[model samples]
Target: MIKSKWTSEQLAWKIRRHGVEMTHLSGGSHLGAILSVADIIATLYTNVLNYDVKNPKWEGRDRFILSKGHAGASIYAALAECGFFDVEELKTHYQNGSRLSGHVSHHLPGVDFSTGSLGHGLSVAVGFAYALKKDGRKERSFVVLGDGECDEGSVWEAALFANHFRLNNLCAIVDHNHMQSLDFNENTLEIENFGEKWKTFGWNVIEIDGNNHQELKVAFKRVEEYTKDENHKPTIIIANTIKGFGIPFMENDILWHYRFPHDGWEYDCAVTALHQIKPEGVEDRYTPNSIENPVLPTEKDDINNDHTFSHTWNTTYPEQMRRVDAKSGTNEKVHNV
Candidate 1:
């Protein structure tokens, strides 16, 4: 594995900044998801995972999977920033015929598994962990999941299987952003006491602030030490995070879950908030013709009109907020936007 010059915090900032740009450039959704999980992804790539940029498929590499694949842009950004591929390829995300699909793709140089379906990634990670344990390999399997994704029965089944065999090499991180596709987890199927659910499945659980780098680092270290024991249970980190974190206006807002930062105030403000300069030449790029496809409309129409046929209602929870400093992009208290 090539050494990373940037610290985990620096890498995280880049991931959040790049994620905003990719979603803006490609008219992709899940900007909220990307923002919520960027820190976790960045921390893993910078501080934990081992891999070769030149040979992503190297056998000695630790396996990393993004179970919450809607936030695939963050992983792509992390890989690009780490030099797995040209960072320039990020601009092609979610565009016509681009390999960087809206969901995470195995076709990418560094991605271990292609995951769009929510509950299956844990299963795949479990398999990898089990195989490595049987082979007596030191490499570990790591997977990131979304809190809403826990609704799937398949995830629990995988959890049971992993614990049954004592797959201590597996590390799962859940981005508990509280809100899922339509509304808050409480409104949609609530999975309260999330950490306990994993504990009940017979896995070791560590709960921490998903956005805080210090907390994440300490949690990862604990995982490493725990796995060293001959008789150890699999570990899962329940990372509490605010949806739409970092961007001031978007923080904890469900609208961003499917809202792309189109060219306008939304795009300009988000880039500025991340302390990044907006990319040039995006105006000349091809945006999807929404009228031709009723399901996908322009961002303007997406905000103004309620196309119930799509079942996407604009639900704003501005009342629910996490104070993130715009300039630093950290979870620091700031005056109201």
Candidate 2:
């Protein structure tokens, strides 16, 4: 166990709970993807990254990019818990006119890059790492990519570039959650010999159970160990993870990739599954609007409500693209309903 004021379990639990709440409240997709990497995110925020949330951009801080940006809520929860923004501001996720778009955005402070298009983030991360190296900065850059994204040629191009340039400051993590959007990765595209693929590209590869906190903590340390050596190269950690990890019902279920749980039975079950033993004195944040007296969101309401949400910069994915969730049914079939 890496030394920290808070245990990795505590951070993981907080991230899992908060992630579910954000996605549930906002009716966002990729909740499974969020859960899958809870432990990894917690480990990084708690153990690896040298960051001060209060100073969103410290000159010497380590930079992390969520290449699988559909899981933006997971990073949002982590940032909030780490004090990047008020925890309450997360409720505005995916809401119209809110700064928190469905996809990851740099508009929010503490976020180094905005990414949603698959196979793009690793390239951006490489650029950041190269710049830091050129400036003779030891501060590292880390990028987390989804397994499904490996199919993109652009991803390979970035990989080759990082290896060619000897970007020892770069560390790439793959969330190898077997299932993709509609089916397993094998159905979409198979990445045979994952570790070999990275080694062949001249990266130092270490495969670990992505959901295991201890493994994640150690894997990052290994990267540091490699960078100090005479023959250093860019490193990649292939993390074997489970989609929809925390909730028993959603585990390994690909449907949750793009489908939001319904407001009725599915929502209740998901929330219940997320908190098997409810935390003491904490109000349930995923409570859906009552059917009888539905409380609809109004644009005029809370326009001035500020909870440390940043408005200093703009991201490529405009706020206009955020999908407004309707208060109704779902085409997604709720299991055991």
Candidate 3:
């Protein structure tokens, strides 16, 4: 039986370790970005999301879209931990002819949408929420966007449309890490007054330490409650995070964004850093029911196998909360949960 109170730190460590393992095997980049957002993904899967591993197509399940699709490795780790797929399959990530790619795909069992292009997921989430509203369904949609991706004009367009319709069921989290593709976001494109910008666009904005599991849980609860009220405004969480969050040398280094760890020493350092942190526990407020033995995918063909991914809904509470860690800029201490 999965425990009710699992540590977020543990999840983050698992994500980092898994990401490193995948990178070592696949020789791919973006490990730093993926590690940075592990906690945010972990919190959502563990504490807030409503879905079943057995029935991935359940209509009542909440939806999560990773707008920053390059972080697919981290998301996949979380999904596997949440019982969406077999963890062993992660070794095939980015492998030739493998379902797991660098970007998220709709073909993945627990993935809600295929996303690689920036500025696309928020709009897709908005559309999903609008349709749910039209059908009188109580489902909610969650999206995580990269800070650098905010430069895209379509993100603002989606914000306008979401606000215009008062799609309160829609929630978006911006990973406010300062770095972008080529340079620091401040140097590349100045986005002064980020909070005010979202508020002006008609969103209920909440800023929190993205690495803190407690704060994340509180923020998620607030968003849920906010959606229940008559207020027709959508919510935006400006999650303050660090680029290259876990590995000391990689933190805030632009080179790490696209660089894979090459030296054995760097790999060893990453492993040690992960070992020092512990996972956060789930809160006592929500109790989980026992989970039955999961049934494995019968045949590879039964798997969606598309490059696209989507999530189905489940109404019952599961045994464990899905947990992952977000990156904190500092290296003084490892914060989990």
Candidate 4:
């Protein structure tokens, strides 16, 4: 088990590091947008979504679709941190025959679906959520779309369908970094009032700083509560984020979106700056289990000491049975089951 909860700052550092590494390895761009969404992606995987690393295909697991596939580097970093795959494999990103392409690939273990083309993820999420609701399942579907991608008419069509179906289990997070491929969002194509647009489309909207973990958690909690009520409208979280959120020189710089870091000084400076920020702990929130097991055990024996003998016995018994079953069968079945 991961002993520490990843702070937004720590996550940003990792994302920046990974982005630099990926660009050096793959000679690609999109680092700025990738960095911008890193905190929200980290928050969803670490604190919000209910997913099992051992069971990536679990039916009850939440679904996360990355609509802006260009931001694949950040998602890859988050997945590696979450134990989906070996972090070293990130070096293969965008290389010939590597599954970690410039865009997200469904072939990846933790990726719920493949996406690269703009304006497609929300529709897929809407379909997934509608099906889950029809089957009376509790799984939630989340889609992250780029603000620039909103220009695609399909996105609005999907929004209309989501509202018509009243799929409250669906949540769409728009990465409003304000820059598209060529120029500023407003200068290229204006989406001046995104919040009102979503609201007008019949979605419950919550606008917040996407980089703030506490705020993201609160927004998601509200979404959860809204889903529980009889009211069944879809929810949209307009996470106002900055492009290249962590790198001092890259923040809000349009060049970073398309320019790959080539010089060692630029890369080193970004990494050094990112490491300067310390992890900020979540505030005013307490979980009974978290309190009971603060500072997670670094070893197996420590786990036994943290809890009573009876509790350890109860917990270890089922785990032992699971391990035995896992050893007795094919690895594929073990993973999928």
Candidate 5:
């Protein structure tokens, strides 16, 4: 067994806290995305995945791909907490010239693939699993995807390929937070009967409350056993997670899909909220919406409201372009989403 330095819960808390700090510092979006998938990443790093920190490229290590690469902060935090690199180096995340891009990057030590465009990561993971199975290696390839990313036809195509090859060594977990970039998933593209779609593709489907640590651990264990069977099929876990899981005000709100904690009130409040989750008794320590702050997009307005749209565009579009200083050989960051 690969014993972790910190328990899954502890790692999850750190990932959440680090996510808040990283997003605040970098003015990066996707903190909500990060929180939704934190526990899944934490559980894998803590108990499920087999890896060597000293030798990240060890051939026997299991491969992990974050298909919803926008949520890269959580995985980066996990890798740092696991000693893949100095945790302090995380401050450079999304900064110009930093290896930590806004999306997951292979330039980092532990990441096997870079994925930001979405939906293509599973294809790469399927290839990895197929190669491992053909070589008769015990190694596995795991992928974490966003529920919104499922709208991509490429994801289903990869699913078909995995089933045809019967790549039992492959496991995929979807962060089914029910929200996309601009609004709730149903309001955008309804992926109803999500698990059934995977089952139709000939995959073993396991649906669970994604934010629950114990359930995540159990789901991973089941997938592990499924991989050992001679006639095993690829498994896809439909992890029904809240869009903004940890912080109370942010939970289930589509506004956070691209909102970062700015330097003042938002940053202070987010840090305070994450700090409330104690190492000993997280449930007792934390209170939902305990801090009295302005509720954005107000109760009267759904995410489609003009205020929400304007806020998103105002916060997201300004950061899209990057400029380089030709003589200084230094890059300047205008904005990052």
Candidate 6:
């Protein structure tokens, strides 16, 4: 793996910032899901996983899967920062002909699995772990799942499989934000004794504040040491996080799950919330489209993909917020903007 200059905290902020920009520009939703897992993704990509940005398909690399694909923007952001792709390409997210889709897509260079459907990622991770073990490979297989996705019976089935085979090289990270879709998980379908349930399934489990980078590093170290010692039990880290994290107005609010960052006040505020550190000289990079940008043709097929913008946006961009270089097409980095 290439050396990472940025620490986990820096990576988390970058992921959150990129997520807000991606959803706002593309008129997409799921910002709450993405923000909730930024630190988890940051920790994994920077501290845990063994990966190379240039050699993404390296056979010896650890396999990382995003089971909760709805929060895919975090993956894209992390990968981009890791040099898997150009950061400027992020603007085309969810746009017509853009490679970055709302859900995780394997078509991207760094992604290992394409999953929008819940309950499948853990199962696939199990299969990968089993295969790696059979081949006598020490490479680990990791999967990130959601607390809400625990409702799928298949998740339990995979849990049993992971324990049954004693896949020590497998690690599952659960983003337990508690809120899912229209309401909280308790109100929707309660999975009481969430941690105990995993323990009962015969897998080693670690529970920690998902947003705390330091705690996350320690948890990953424990799991890594256990697996490296040839301990033949899969491990799962249940990371507790707040939905719409880093954003004051959107935090713990179910409305942000499906809400779009409208062009004017809404978009600006959303970006502000995602950006906790707006250092000097880092002007806003996103230009609110004064005219309605056409949505991708495939959007019509999915009702949740629908987007509508009011004419609340202004045509003129403040000089301070401008990012596009008139002479050169390349965008300027406004302090990692």
Which model scores highest in lDDT? 5
Please report the candidate that would top TM-score against the real structure.
5
lDDT of 5 by residue, 1-337 (tens): 3556889999898888888878888899999899989989999999899999888999989999999999999989999889999988899989999988999999889899999998899999999999999999999999999988999999999999999999999999999998888877777788998988999999999999999999998999999899989578999999999977888868877778888877555665666667677475333222344345533443453433332332455533333376777999776777553
**Steric overlap count per candidate:** 0, 0, 32, 0, 1, 0
lDDT of 1 at 52: 92
Decreasing lDDT order of the candidates? 5, 1, 6, 2, 4, 3
TM for candidate 1 is 0.82
Q: Alpha carbon lDDT of residue 186, candidate 3?
A: 78
Give candidate 3 regions above 4 Å deviation.
1-6, 278-337
The deviation in Å at residue 95 for candidate 5 is 0.8
Candidate 4 residue-wise lDDT, 1-337, digit = tens = 2222565556655666788778866888898898899888877776678777777898878888999999988888888767888878888989999989999998988898888899999999999999999999888899999999999999999999999989989999998988887667887789989899999999999999987878898998999898886458999999999988877767877777877766445555555555556344422111112222223223442111212222233322333343333566642322324
**TM-scores for candidates 1 onward, in order:** 0.82, 0.80, 0.80, 0.80, 0.84, 0.82
Predict model 5's lDDT versus the native: 0.85
Deviation of model 5 at 235, angstroms: 0.3
C-alpha lDDT of residue 219 in model 6 = 96
Q: List, residue by residue over 236-328, the lDDT tens digit for candidate 3.
A: 999988877876656776666776755354555555555445344421111122112323334442222211111222344443442334465
Candidate 1, which ten residues in sequence have the lowest lDDT sum?
282-291
What are the runs in model 5 whose C-alpha is more than 4 Å off?
1-3, 281-337
On a 0 to 100 scale, what is the lDDT of residue 296 in model 2?
37
Model 1, position 334, has a per-residue lDDT of: 32
How do the residues 1-337 of candidate 1 rate in per-residue lDDT, one tens digit apiece?
6466667777777777778778887788999899999889989988999999989899999998999999999999889889888988999999999989999999999998999899999999999999999999999999999999999999999999999999999999999999888778877887988888899999999999999989999999999998897579999999999888887767777788998887766776676666532223222112222122223335664343322223464344353355766798777433354
Q: How far is candidate 1 from the true structure (C-alpha RMSD, Å)?
A: 13.4
Candidate 4 matches the true fold with a TM-score of 0.80
